[model samples]
Target: MTAVTDQDHTDQAGDAGSENREGPVEEPVGGDADRGGKDGHTRVESAKGGPARAEAGPGRARAEAGPARGETVENAEGQADADSAGGWDDGLIARRVTAETEQAAAVEVRGPNAPPAAPLAYDAPLHSRLDALRELVGLSRARLDSRTLAEAGQVLDEAAARRRLSGQHTVVAIAGATGSGKSQLFNALAGVAISETGVRRPTTAAPIACSWSDGSASLIERLGIPPRLRRRPLQSAESEAQLRGLVLVDLPDHDSAAVQHREHVDRILALVDAVIWVVDPEKYADAMLHERYLRPMAGHAEVMFVVLNQIDRLPGEAAEQVLDDLRRLLDEDGIALGEYGESGATVLALSALTGDGIGELREALGQFVAERGAPARRIAADVDAAAWRLRPVYATGRRTGLSEEARDDFAARLADAVGATAAGEAAERAWLRNANRACGTPWLRLWRWYQDRREPPTGRLPLRAHPEEEATARQRVEQAVRTLADRASAGLPAPWAQAVREAAVRGSQGLPEALDELTARAGLPPGRPPRPGWWPAAVLAQASMTLLQIVGGLWLVGQIVGVMAPNLGVPVLLMVAGIIGGPLVEWSCRMAARGPARRYGVEAERRLREAASGCGRARVLDPVAAELLRYREVREQYSRVVGV
Candidate 1:
């Protein structure tokens, strides 16, 4: 292989001059000695140069006619290798579009010195795009409508199968309705009658392939063609050499009366790299072809050719009129015609019997075959169509992620559902009741105990919910989940939104019970909070006051029985002081207990609320967040696929 240098690019550009070129043609493969002259990178002997270099001539100019190629081939060490330049990335879409667009315009129309065509590359590589589509489909399969994604899946499967086969051979299928002379045209293109053709309504019952070169067996087999049905060109050496690397398939009549024949046509058409629709003047505007296939496959203009075959039946300009009318119909069907050499659907007129316009068709096909880009172009178009179909699901009005406020609201709801606040209030009341029992006046305490003895004893403070509170708690939990789902799914597509909703619902099951369990295990202080030392002192003081009261009462009884001398009412004063002081001590203890009771209640509430929030996050918010994360990942993949 010869080393391509900067001069070679310049020479190629100079040769291109001011005219655009058609499809790119690959440089002929040869040994190093055959490629390089005396110089390492030169093809022709130069007087000023050290070695001979290749020059771009009229015939060889088309091979290098695209935009000055900016892309390079690299070796394992990441260095550019001119020897491998023609192998990798040859039949890619960017190159094809550049070549076709240049060929479509004139130098006069597109300025004389129009800058070299801008490099066009896939937004993402083909494999990456396909992988994105596969993952998107897998994730969305259960959530989305199956019918909507079926086309994308089919595109993925077909692309994989086609890419696995031979990249050297371009498979072109000749498809047409019955009695449309498609078989005749197929035989005409192959330069031999390899496919059977007759006056029968469906002459071609099965597809037959004719290859112009070797190494296409896998491709033929992929099309489901049996060995017996596959044939070679069997034409003159020159004819075979001209159409090298082309695998022409003659498909069954698409409009055949036989269901199997029509099925065969449709099946083969989908797998073929390019399709040549051979229509006669009579059925050129057939509704079946336009409605069913052409309109639906409008995006595949790069790999489509609409041939008005059998134009010999029409007189002089009638054929031209029909061709113009056909172009109009194709436009209406949304197929872009490759007018003025543009890179789009190629439409032409020809007759297999008369041989008129046959040379022009052959010339165009030769350019197409020489390029070996039809398969890549077809696959790229399929990807574009699939991506377009999937646009709605991926395109969002705004971000639909879970919000912080929403999470906080959910946690609060769960806390309420488990009755954390109510439990705290109960704790405060329990502390107050215990304090009153321990420090109240002795006689009063006795009287209260005797009064409560008649009623059943309540074992423990009521920390859990009553039956009615339990029902209310359940409702609160359900509402929290519902609100979270609504917030998370806002502005999302129907499928993704529904998936988020389902995720929230799935994680919410058993959540209320789980929160209740968490509250129970919240490690709250069990009975009355740890007693303060001052509580004991208060209790002793109350006992002393009670003693004083008893002493004063005994003395009064003695005086009444006349067992003692006259007193100055000391017993009465002592009784009055004891009575006032005891009530005052009890009131002081009650006031002091308020601070500790409030602190203890707050601690209990904190523990319960913390546990409830953590539970809610694990059971509900975490799952919802996971789902949202998945959506974000898939959205990024979708952007890569769409080249956003």
Candidate 2:
């Protein structure tokens, strides 16, 4: 382990000189090393993106890759040792961060000379927040924009890697523009010349890590810092003891002319737990600093420390004026400022050159590190920022999925499309036609039958669209589907609304044909139209009248032939009575059949209407409702992620 002493200025300068002579020997892991990690662990790879051998310690050999899947390693005690090479499993940090008091009863074995481990603060709420985000993405990935869902997943993955590496250590980066004295402040905090400071523009090209305690290798490695660039502060001062879990980083100038340097700064800033933004009097209000970084990261005020470096350069009263102006600028950038123990950004003035106000800054940092909550707070702020960005996509005022009025209107439209009304009217007319045939005058019936032999009277009653209506039936059905979709998606967010419409369209693929088939099946009856109970009596009466007419005609014929004499014109009277009675009986039967025929037609209309309405509800309306329901469920999951 590399350690510095309070009385080792010469050795510190010598160490810095050796690092410069070796050129930039610290190579970042992987090509895009600053992308954080995947699966809750940092991606440790060689410079060429391949696995490389690593030195774990003086006597122990380490492999970049772990054991093969399902392979186990045993320690000297013949016990299973899963953390032999990687030191700990990926889930170890997660379990430690989220474990409750009840689980603390389990015992852990330690080496004879190993010191007792620090107690971990339980942050189950933060873990729960990450879980909520994961669930939300899983449920809404298809319904939402792919970019939004990807961003949410990135947040979860970043959180997992960070917490797994070191939940107790708070990684704080000192960042600023060129010639902003940030490197000077970093060295002063370390009490050694760890980061080189000079007048050259963008003196720091990459981040340097100075951890106050041991056991920070995993965290430093996760930050993409090479082993050679890692340093240790003097472990002799009581003031330094309070900062045991602090990992201070010196970042390159954010506004550097070199694109690669600026990229490095941005990537490192994204993964750090907190930031101590160092600004000077000359460039304290630079537009690049505020517009590019501070304004965009306003939600992270809880983990920000805005320090005005080089206060010694400003005149006595000018320093105060400049500090006040900086505060105003930060406020305009939407960063809340806190005084000492509040929940906002800490704004203060210090001079690394004169060591003025450095004591106050150290005290504040010590208190912050002692709390052991910076990791959780930074993760929470990240979640807040992501949730706010997605607010417009998932928010809505509508609680109900489908309205009753809209459903009824869709059913009515389907009934009309199936021609329910016209079918009922046709059935009523068919009943009348059949009744007329059964009870009309006998001579008229015979004439109709004779006429029917030449040209048959066609009487087939079935519910179906007219020849002209076939073309527009599908169009009417599609309109009903669109109407239901619109009703279900009202006031919904854009993504979910589109989803509902899509579901409606998908369910409507074969609906028109199905509805046509339904009506066809409902239209067929077993036999001819049902006959009323009084039909037989009417037939008998008609037969009797016909007999009388025949008798009268024969008597008249006999009288005219002089074979027998007629009595008091009885033959003529009988013929007249038979003709009038036959017509009267037909009229009475027609009137009686009207009421029953009308009822049957109405009943047929009701049944067909119900059948058409049911078909529509099953195909179109149900899918739309399901989409709405899925949106509601995902929205609630998003709310839980936001902790609302």
Candidate 3:
């Protein structure tokens, strides 16, 4: 923010820049500084501090200041210079006019070196962002692989810690390969001697933190920066006030020979809210940088900055060419460019040693600090990255459960294997046995009783299913479950499909025994239907017929003996009636048993089948159903995690 007084012109940018720096920040970092050859062109990749050294290029040091490369930066610098002139005094005409001429302000936001600053962040709040990250981690644990789960958990913890300790503070880390002058860039950005900058092979063994406010102590501690290396905000001048609440971290070199140094860089890279990757012109196109870090962090483009440090070495056109090439590499890395770009990776050119682009970098950082959305954006990016990592877990879409027809077929197969039909037949036969005892003709029933005495049927069901059937029943049940699992997990990922299969078999272990037990306890249909009124009549007629026969026999005997009056005609008629009625009544009772017995057989079979079905459902279908339910739950969880 620039202070404005009665003077029509305001020098807000100058005021901020002046407080931070009296002149450009300068320091020497270890490495060959030759950046180009005769044509002022150098290969995209220049080996730095290595055995192979390239010859020096013409005017390499100041070549980048040529017209072509300085087109944009020079214009900015020129405007700032013009703005720094004594004062703006325009002739005033005191007259009423419909329109007034006004000149637009050419705000020199950054110095000649850094790129233009971007707009403030437009993301959710820090807590919400961290909360979202935690939610993603929880979901991943249930539905994703171990690697994804661990990554999400780590990100969640780090993000929460950073947010808890630093309220509305932006943590911008300076990361680069060895000899990239990353430390120098860090110090330049702070406009103070905060980080150790030297020509040593590995100058920074540990991360150095420079804060612009006292609020960052806890934040720096959370970031794992030792208190010894921690520097308080520079309050000696008012310029640094613009950078208050900013925590600038100088990380160990990513390409350091020491494994510990590289590990430190990796650890710090993950925790920082934002990162400014310092790339020297020599190693600008290093594959290790792009492949290992930039490509993987494509989702975090918004909070990333790719700075081409030491641009002072390239000719004007050569510098432009290098920047263009760097942009190409970053694009290949899938990193985006600006807030307005589809991605969020900001690209710029600067020389930390010369401080040519330090003002621009500072301006950009100032805007970033002012935005106060770095934490939110960073956490959001992490969540997105986590989601992408677990993409394969849910690549396949959700499929509904097995069809009703398929299930019925499976059930029918199970019933057959369980001997449901056999049980029903036995029940029907049992019903018939009872029916006959209740309604059969008395004489014939006595005959049946005598026959049963010769060979009585066992009390146990005559139609009982054989125990040998248990094997076939178990096999059929297992097959049915397997089929159901296959269909349910058709398009699912391998792990989830395997889960469904395991779930299907969970209830199948003791199934055969259970079915056997069920069959053993299966109830047969009860017998003894209510007797009809005609049964009693029939019995009485049969008894009376017998008495009539006896009378005929006695009459005939008396006639022959001449002891009483002879009655041949009446006796004959009675005898004929008794014989015919007896036979007819017996026949009628036998015929009545036919229809009732048939019906009883059908009803008994139905009951037996029902019992068999119950066993099949509990032992077979129940387990399969459980698996399907689990599948549905997991599918829903993945859907939530991926937002699909």
TM-score of each: 0.66, 0.75, 0.66
| lDDT (10s digit) by residue, model 3, range 1-644 | 11111111123223222221322211111111223322221111112211122233332111111111101110000112223312322111111111122111111111233322232233344445455546545544654567657876776666656555555578889999988988778756654444556666777777877666434555666666644355433233444567866888888889889998888888888888899999998998888998898899888888998899898988867878998999888878778778454557778888887788888888878887888878777877887787677656645655556678767776676667666676556555555565455445456678888887897462345432455555567777678667766776677777666766776677567766776666556644243443455667656767787778778888888888998698899888887877776677666755875576567556655665666667657765676666566556655654554444
Q: Which ten residues in a row have the lowest lDDT in candidate 2?
A: 102-111
Question: What lDDT score goes with residue 633 in model 1?
Answer: 81
| Stretches of model 2 off by over 4 angstroms after superposition | 1-124, 339-342, 397-400, 438-467, 532-591
Clash total of candidate 1: 6
lDDT of 2 by residue, 1-644 (tens): 11111112122223223212222122211112111123111112222212333222242222233222212111110122332333333221111111111110000111123232343343777778788888888988778768877768878888877756766678899999999999889867866445767676767776778777544556777778864455555334563577778989898889999897788788888888899999999999899899999999998998999999999988879999999999999999999888655689999999998889888899889988888788788889888888888888888866657878899899888888888888787777778767877888888788877876896343435444376687687788889999888889888988889999999999899988899888877763655688899999998888888877888888888898887786638988888878888988889989998998898788778877888988887888888888888888888888888997
Least lDDT summed over 10 consecutive residues: which range in candidate 1?
Answer: 100-109
**Candidate 1, residue 378: lDDT:** 85
**Global fold similarity of model 1 (TM-score):** 0.66
* Backbone-clash count (model 2): 0
Candidate 2, position 530, lDDT = 87
Error of 3 at 162 (Å): 2.5
Clashes of each: 6, 0, 10
lDDT of each: 0.70, 0.71, 0.60
- Residues 1-644 of candidate 1 have per-residue lDDT tens digits of 12122223334435545232421111111112212223222122222112233443333332232233322111111222233322443221111111111111101111122223221122247778778888888877766788988988998888877766777678999999878888778767755444556665667767877776556667877888754455554335566667877888888888888898888888888888899999998899999999988998999998999999999899979998999999999999989999887889999999987678778888888789888788878888888888888888877979789888988888888888887787787777667767877889987788878976995342234455378877888899999999999999998877788888998999899998888777778845555566777998999999888888888877888888888765839888778778987888889999999998888778778888899989888878888888788889878878877767
